[model samples]
Target: MSISRLSSALVASLLLFGAACGDDTVGTSPNNMTTPPGVDVPIPMGSKLQHTGQCAGQVNCQVDVTFNSSAPLQVRVIDGNGAPVVGAAVRYELSVGLAVGTSLNAASAQTNSDGVAQVEIRAGQATGAAEVIVSLPGDTSVAPIKFVAGVQPKDSASYSVTFEHAGTASLRDIKVFLYKAEDSCDAIREDIARERDDDASTNPVLTAEYTANGVASVDGTLPLVVFPGLSNGQSFNVAAQAMSRDDGEVELAFGCTDSNPPIENGNSVNVIVRLEDHLPRLKGSFDVTHTFSITDAICDPQPNGGYAGVLPSGVCLAIDLIGRLATDPASFILGEGSGDTGIIGLIVDFLPDDGILGTLKGAIESFLGNSLIQNLGRDALNEFFATWIENNAPDWVKGGIDITADIYESLQEFRVNGIIRIEREPDPTLDTETNTVVGLLNADQDGNRPGKQVWEDIIVYWTGDCASSAPAACRERTFSATDLGATSSVVEGSFTGTVVPLTGEGETGFGLIINEHTLALNYGVLILGIIEQVVLPSIFGPTVTSLEAALNELLLLVLPGGTTGCQGFADFMVDNIGSSVETIARNLCESLLESASDGIREFLTENLTISGEDNFLLATPTGTPCKLVEPEAYTGAWIGKPLPYIDGLGTDSMLCEWDVKIRISQDTIIETDGTFSGNRTGF
Candidate 1:
């Protein structure tokens, strides 16, 4: 063999044998110590390294900066094909927003022999994340690190709201709602739409229900809100609503969401609205100083003689007349929103609870020019007429009519032929004291509106022969009201004596003694009082228990529960004997029963448990205190506690709660709000 050939062959054989013995692949492999087949080693841009920490439960990761460099820089670590190379360079440049140290010129120490390195972060360094690059000569082992520093735990806030009128207000249709403030933060961006749904739709929306006593209410905790991209100055608004089935008196307030609904909650403010309003029932704006006309058939200047200037001391009827004037239906509805009114000479329907009008008695004794015949004094009757005008007439109606005292007539035609309709106004100002309409009636302007009185007196004088000489002057004042003021027409009845001019001009001139107008008042109320004062036991044959409930409600306002007031109220009801009072008591009894049922239901549903999912994770330079970060680079891991769950329960599990449901019905209807009486028909 040749010497040269022998040496070359021996060297080639040795090289091949050494490669086969090591088991190290030439190309990159997952566990390969050298560069992998396809992966390239990264190059470093700077000398400092920065990083932040995060866990699986996080929706966001902190980008806190640890070490910083003044000039453009980079960070890197050495790695083979699959793992971190022990000697690669990683660096980055820092800006004010990304500054972790006072000086950007700071740098981190080089890696150890195995390629591990950590930079020292300065104290009082601003928090933020800085982008870093990994530089390597044709070897890309380390990926770019999403570096961050300075993590903090945040605090949260919660709210709650309730209503003031949830229990005993006259008008009880009110709704209240709350909303979480929308913000500009990326993590909570979708919360805005979710909040709207939570407040308006599938709401944990609190609500009030109607009971016989009407004591149900709404209240609860409100969730927190965050803005998308916002850093400061966050707030919210709350809205309130008033509702009604029939128009009932209701009041509202705006402030903060609280038990009172009047006080303010930290984040929520209130806006109140009234659904029903009932006030100012009666109205009068004009001066009523004028004297009303006094109608009398005996005032004729004929055979019977009486002195002038002084009206007889007899009770009399003031000759005043009016029509059903309708200018504003919203304010005045004769037979509509009003209660029962006695016959006003019109085809008006009466409501079930309305009162009747006064009775019509003798008009002759009133204007007979003798005080002896009048049941009420003539001065009293006259005063009543004027006072009614002053108190009940509108400001415009005072100057409408023209008349004199010489007209001799009877005010009966209106009643005989239904020309006037009288309906009672609604009494919303129920006296918590008397429980009557006395004070409320004073505020009623609906029954009688402005511009109603057109004529001073509705005289129906006798439509007899003008040339007749018969001696029947007593039956003379009888005629249709339409015939008045017809020029040159035959007079309904002849005025016998001399004519006189009345001074001061307030329906006072003498021509002929004629027509008069008459109206009915609500005397039934007085009659009831009389009956109650007179025969007590007969009217309330049932025991006091039948009427106790009504008296109890009244006492509730004036008297407190379980006190002397309550006892006095109970005794008062037992002592009283009136059918009307008994009826009121019956209604109150039903209400009490309803209230008792509601209290039971409230006790049954005291607390509840809810279930929800919280799943999230963070991706970054893989530095985590939870020990989830892997030793190698370019992968993900977990460093958090396991998700919270019900003890001994599986992943797909629910809380089982046991409660005794107190129901108003034999069985209840289960709804999202809770249970309701299944038989609403009975309710």
Candidate 2:
């Protein structure tokens, strides 16, 4: 009678087959069964539930689904006899929650041969919980099962990072910058460019500083990078950099937002980056040091050349006179190859060769013959000597003689003191600048014209007796000279020149030339006395002095082949001795110039370096940085002493001493004390 029960005819059929009915089927068991009442029979289907995909975790009674996401809901249909109902129909229904917008594809579907029917449950864009039910169409014996699903905001996340090096974790006082995916253009471009051997340029989106060692934090003080509005499956790139305090070098890190715990759909993610340094760093300063020596090749007082006493040849008398007269004070010794040695070494070493003295002698002779001594012509000189011979009454003197004899000597003490300063121009070009450094020799800063007066405060002291006690040639002590005072004197003029950089291919070079300059000697007391008293009377004595007249007449008794009168002897001695001192002073100036320009070049070329972390020079790929610092200014001072400059190799060689100080600044030199001194032995 009840529609839910199986019919008697069906029961008769079941009895004939000895089948049984059970409650495991879609509805209650059939009304009739051939088996015993307690017997349980097979059932092809049950009221149990199951699901696939996003809805798999849903309760069997109430399957849930996500918004805008699709999933399958299935149920099996069978007969009370536990056999599948080939064409049975199943009903489906959806119950959407209050904030959800979604629905099922169909409310009903026919069961397949396996007694199963599936309906796809699709969700809407809105987020909220939803439910689905599955059951037999008209049979109320079995309860419908329900499944639930939910749609929430998409997954999104964020990250924080720190840097480290050589196991040291602290990254103090370094700058950090973060760039978004779009803003990471600089990082990507640089990466590609570096691959092609090109230079890289940087660009950043946001920046922050790290004060803690090794740690860059993203907290309340520093906000973490957030991707707040990303939907499912979307992502972006990220780049960051940490830089040195001095801006000398940098380190970089890169990442992607698409990584797990992904930035998409309200999800959050965290990242950490460790950096390694590869770029070169910038430098601040560098330095170089040099030591120089002094030698007798240029400083020797003996014009005769080579060591004294070793050779049989005697010393030159003219050299001895000039050397002793040009004394360098003991307080300021200029050239000290060895500590406290003397200016004789300094002045002489800086001067030219003895051969140059010969040239100066010719020059002086020309000047005297044409100007100062013009009053005494050759014929007059002959007549004067002839008169002396007539009055003296010597048979050998009846014929006039040639008064030309070689007078060789060595100086007891030759002294010179001066200031050598180096300076650089304000605007120096690269390698091509001319006269960038202006050299002032003994420059005067206090006079009417500052930096214009040169060769100032020069001292040439001569205080020694000349002429041997024995009579080798003329009468003994007849033409003797003594006690040239030790008073100091200065040259009247100055020397100005320019220093040029002789830069060659990959090496440092130097050059210098005196542009507009002059060093004029203002012969003071000693020189004037020698010219007027000693020289004037020594060779032309018979004609000009009674003391020499008697001696000249007595010379014939000693031997033959000698000058009865002072014919040409005065000119010869004056020419050789007088001209020699001039050349010596000039040569000394040249030596000072060479020391400055050449010394600077050699020091830089051999010693400059750029990168290693110390006082010694460190080299870089570019070049040695020390070479880049140009000379700015210079200041110098010197004091002479009585200590003689003696050679370590020979006991006979000796000269005056000087203590000199030359302070040079690369930018500008200010003379706190404009002290200068000059000494000259002139005709």
Q: Whose lDDT is greatest here?
A: 2
Scanning candidate 1 in windows of ten residues, the lowest lDDT window is: 674-683
* lDDT by residue (tens digit), candidate 1, 280-377: 11222111111112222322322233322112211111111111111111111111112211111111111122332111111211122233322122
lDDT of each: 0.24, 0.31
Q: Which is the leading candidate under TM-score?
A: 2
What's each prediction's TM-score?
Answer: 0.18, 0.21
Query: Residue 261 deviation, candidate 1, in Å?
Result: 14
